[model samples]
Target: MQAVPNAFSVLSHPSLDHSGGGRASSEVPRPATLFESAELLKGGKIVGIMHNGSLYRLQATKLGKLILTK
Candidate 1:
């Protein structure tokens, strides 16, 4: 008999749609530090890519990927 490979599902596409149509917003008014981001991540919040030095969160899904709200 042949062994079957395990299947997997992508939780989030880090490149494709982390922004979520640019609708998400940032809770932090000022620039967030790495430690802050870590805290957010620990709370199950997606950490968006830093662009021009800013952090944001997903507004729609509430559990989706992060985006540059600023």
Candidate 2:
């Protein structure tokens, strides 16, 4: 099976070069990783996530929405 990415990136504005006086146009950032909820749950209704030594639960509701709780 393919390994899942540990982190996902969100779209961010162009980075600013503090000393360069303009946006760092030459430094292209890596594209964000995307994952489908079905892939994450693996055909299950719920999944557990461990973050910073704490447990988080991701649940899919009957209404086709998702919720995360600590």
Candidate 3:
């Protein structure tokens, strides 16, 4: 199956009448990085993502899909 666009959009949809009523809808500050998909490769189909002193592995699956792991 394919991934849906804006997978996080449901959190802000008006149709959901949650008690909070969009209190946290404002943008959360995040570090932005401009990189291309090709740059993620080290040599093969693997790359590394660093966050909070932890290392994460991103790899292209045999099925031509991406998977991330800690």
Q: Could you list the CA RMSD of all candidates, in the order they appear?
A: 14.8, 7.1, 7.5
TM-score of each: 0.20, 0.59, 0.47
What C-alpha lDDT values do all the predictions have? 0.41, 0.73, 0.64
What tens digits encode model 1's per-residue C-alpha lDDT throughout 20-62?
6743334423322223333556665454556667765533245
TM-score (C-alpha, index-matched) for candidate 2 = 0.59
Measured by TM-score, the strongest candidate is 2
Q: Give the per-residue Cα lDDT of candidate 2 at 25.
A: 48
* Candidate 2 ranges beyond 4 A from true positions: 1-28
Model 3: lDDT of residue 58: 90
lDDT of 3 by residue, 1-70 (tens): 2344554465345554354673543555233333445557756888889999999999988787888999
Candidate 3 segments exceeding 4 Å error: 1-35
Candidate 2 residue-wise lDDT, 1-70, digit = tens = 3545553333334443454555544666655656788989999999999999999999999998999999
